[model samples]
Target: MASFLALLPRSLTTFLYAVAALLRFYGNIDTTPISKIPLTILQWSFITFILGTAALLANLGLEWNAGNRSRNREIEERNRADQERQRAVSRARIQNRFFLLQTRHQLTPSPETRTALADFLSFLQEYGE
Candidate 1:
């Protein structure tokens, strides 16, 4: 959007120059009377060109903003989905560990395994929340 806005002035200038060249061409013709043609036509053409260019620039800005918003929405959705997956995996591991502990009727886990599971659960909570 910024880039297009930057180019807008240049584009308008070029369009005005082209219009002037066309008018000059018509003016050069040996028609009945060049002076009689309303100068309003040239003035109106320049005004119309400027208005049209402004509209075009506004449209480009709107589209660019919408596209960026859509991309951000997509990224947010992807992150949410990833977090959900991680939570599901962590829940499953915790349940499995609990089940094994129940079957063995033991409250104690091997130190290394306990530390690893605790760390994994902490990571899941940090990201999934």
Candidate 2:
């Protein structure tokens, strides 16, 4: 099937050429031709090639721009996810600190306990600094 399909165009081309030759022979066509026709056809072919190249370049440019936009969107999404994770971590740390302070206050509930809590907080602050 592939071979037959491949031969089809060659057969068609030969048949058309034979038909054109026969017609031209029978019609007794003049040998004279316009000189500008070939040049015009050549110029038109060149223009067509240029237009095709321009269209291909434009398509490539559009594809490249679309790829860049997709990449940028992915980067932005990753950055957003990272920022959300950082915020979650910060919130967890703050909650942990709050719970720890509450527990310490509950464990020690007298004037001496207050002084102890102040001293502990100061120690923590100094250590942190």
lDDT of each: 0.71, 0.66
Instruction: Assess candidate 1 and give its lDDT.
Output: 0.71
lDDT of 2 by residue, 16-109 (tens): 4454455455444434432755433334444444555555565566668769999999999999999999999999999999999988876877
The C-alpha RMSD of each candidate to the native structure, in angstroms, is: 13.0, 13.8
Instruction: Kindly report which residue stretches of model 1 are placed more than 4 angstroms away from their true locations once superposed.
Output: 1-39, 106-129
The number of clashing residue pairs in each candidate reads 0, 0
